[model samples]
Target: MTRRVLPYRTPSENVISAEDWHLVTPDGDIAAPEALPDWDYRMNLRLRRVVNVDLDRARTESGLPADAPLLLSAVWTATGSNLSGPAQHLRLPRAGTVPMKIDFELSGTNLGGLLLLDTALVLAERRPDARPASPRRAGSILWSDRRALRLQGDAPQFPMAVIDFSLTSFPDNAAWHLQISGSLESATMGALLLLVNERNTVTATAFANAAKPRQIDRLVLSAVYADAARLMVEHALSHEDFSEESDYPDDSLGATMLILFDRLFPDQSITDMRLRQRQSPSLFASDLQAAVTIFEVS
Candidate 1:
């Protein structure tokens, strides 16, 4: 029998929250950043660790209520590079909007997908509010790594919500290109475990698929950042070595990056994300010290 998935995003819950938001125009036209109605996000990531996978007890995700809602969601999968095209094509989750106008589009960045998203210019800034986001309290199986989580706030004092999801290297859905998928499935935590173990192997037989092992762990994280500027600084510093082509092949830039990140994080677990400022005094001179948060989950 075919397995079923769940709706990753809920109405009342949020994937990531910013307590104080100043939606800005790209050209800096508007002083205050109003919530954007047209936008989309996608993640081409793979799970790193596994705690469990119970196929028989799978559950699906659903919509959220007025009090709480699912602001973001992603579907992950990896498959045979041989049987596929140059990059993985992902099917998007059934997108919903708020203020009834915020439209979105998500495409996995397997290789060329990143280039496509860069064209849209998705803007995300970190907000450090006092209160933690509550989804489980509202009833939802929100899972995320600290490295991939952030807070959304009402102003700047206290967070109105929390973030609890990240994209691991999952396979892209084939139907996304033509918009032909009948419906989006609600993936379970257990099904997620199975994905982590797949490793996106493209040439494996059915028996070989069963032999794969899963690597994933679930843990709640509490982290902090002074502001979005500080976080951006951290990110710039971390990416200083992003273009190093010495360790990878000349043709494989994106794949090389994925491998590089995995290597940097031997533990294979991302938690408690933060932006680090440059060392004080001489070393901190210029823009080197004021880099943004060092994070990349593509």
Candidate 2:
């Protein structure tokens, strides 16, 4: 593996040691695996890890002052949603070995695809009088590491919520609704939501067991996915601005829809599909049903 060359001195690789991340579950905490096949928007992730830093050796190797302020921090990034933010931060001891514990609670709505965890040790404050080859700038990295966890491997990979339909304008008996709002330029996470009616126990239960779905639950989920895809495609088709030539920001709603459209209608152009939908609405619906392969057994 190639290593990044820093202009300033850095500590040895052994200065910081981190344990594998643990996934906190209701039963107990377990070592996080490479992937979570059943992870969904309704599930929030709780993770924890322990790290030990040899501060004395780190400072000496990096030519930092004896009283230098160092910081240990963790940050998280979700590739699907294109969202990222700080997770945890702690001040390192001025001298001696320091042990730090990191706990991260990530919301499901803000996460999708790959979940990346970044941990780093940095100079917390600027030091102008430090040695010439020493780290002198604030936030100068001394050591860092990254870990990744795959969340899901399918479509409709958006945020979701379960609530009582009776409390809203939607029909009380509606099993679920896919809500799409905002312009295509908006972030996909903020533009789409899958709302399952809590009173619709069948639909709600299907999602609750999505991670380990039974045969019946699988059928229910497949139906839900097909319907959700239909709604998403129709919504995209309704917007004239959505086209193959249009440039959209990465992770934007328009970008997401463009990808979905390509997957659903591989060889068909947007103009042809739009014309077909307008000429024969019924036939278009059939075509979409076939495209989604609704309720097909896997």
Candidate 3:
């Protein structure tokens, strides 16, 4: 394994010990897995972990004053939304081992793709009178660890909400609607939304119990997925810049659309598909329906 070499003297590898993160769920907390298929835009991710830091050893090895202050911090970044923020922060003891428990919660709307959690031990304040070859700057890293959780699943990943359709101009009976906005170059998180009407109990409940869907729920979800895929494909084809040669930013809507297009129509050229779509819209609809395999089980 490759290790980072810091500029100044640092604590040994055993200075910090951290437990694996746990995912909090309705049933109980489970060890966080490589991926969460049931996660949706409406859900929130709750995670917990414990960390133990040898503060006294850290200070002594780094040649710092005994009273030097330290900090333990956790920060999170979401690749899907291209957003990041602090999850938790704690002041470390000046001596002896310090055990800290961190409970972190993040909204699904602001998260997508991969969720990365970074925990670090750093100098809380600058020490001007520190010993030679020691870390003296504030926020100087002493040690750190990182964990990742994949948020993307089989479904088209995007933000979502459940509201009454009657509240707006939408038809009261409409089951669901995908609202896509902004330019293709815009961030995906701000570009797509899956809005489910609460009046449509079947559709709403399918998403609500997505983590543990029954057979009937699977059927409903399959239908929704098919329709949503159709809408996204049509939207992508409508744009002239959505071509194979077009390069979009990693987190852009165009990039997401390109991924969906490739998945739905692998080895198919965008130009050929676009021409077919324009010449025969109905045929295109049928083709998309077949590609999504609506109502089919895995």
Model 1: per-residue Cα lDDT at residue 175: 10
Return the TM-score for candidate 1, rounded to 2 decimals. Answer: 0.15
CA lDDT for candidate 3: 0.87
Backbone clashes per model, in order? 60, 0, 0
Model 2, C-alpha of 31: deviation from truth (Å): 11
Candidate rank order under TM-score: 3, 2, 1
Model 2 C-alpha lDDT per residue in residues 161-189, reported as the tens digit of each score: 99999999999999999999888888777
Residue-wise C-alpha lDDT for candidate 3, range 1-298, written one tens digit per residue: 3578998999998988898899988899999998887666657899999899888898888888899999889999988877899999999877888788989899888898788999888999999887779999999989888888888665677888899999978899999999999988887877888999999999999998887788888999999989889888889999988898889987688988898898889978999899999999899888899899888975
How far is each candidate from the true structure, as Cα RMSD in Å? 24.2, 4.6, 3.7
- Misplaced by over 4 Å in model 3 are 1-14, 17-50, 60-69, 99-107, 123-140, 148-152
lDDT of each: 0.23, 0.88, 0.87
Model 3 RMSD vs true structure: 3.7
Which scores higher on TM-score, 2 or 3? 3
Q: How far out, in Å, is residue 99 in model 2?
A: 7.6
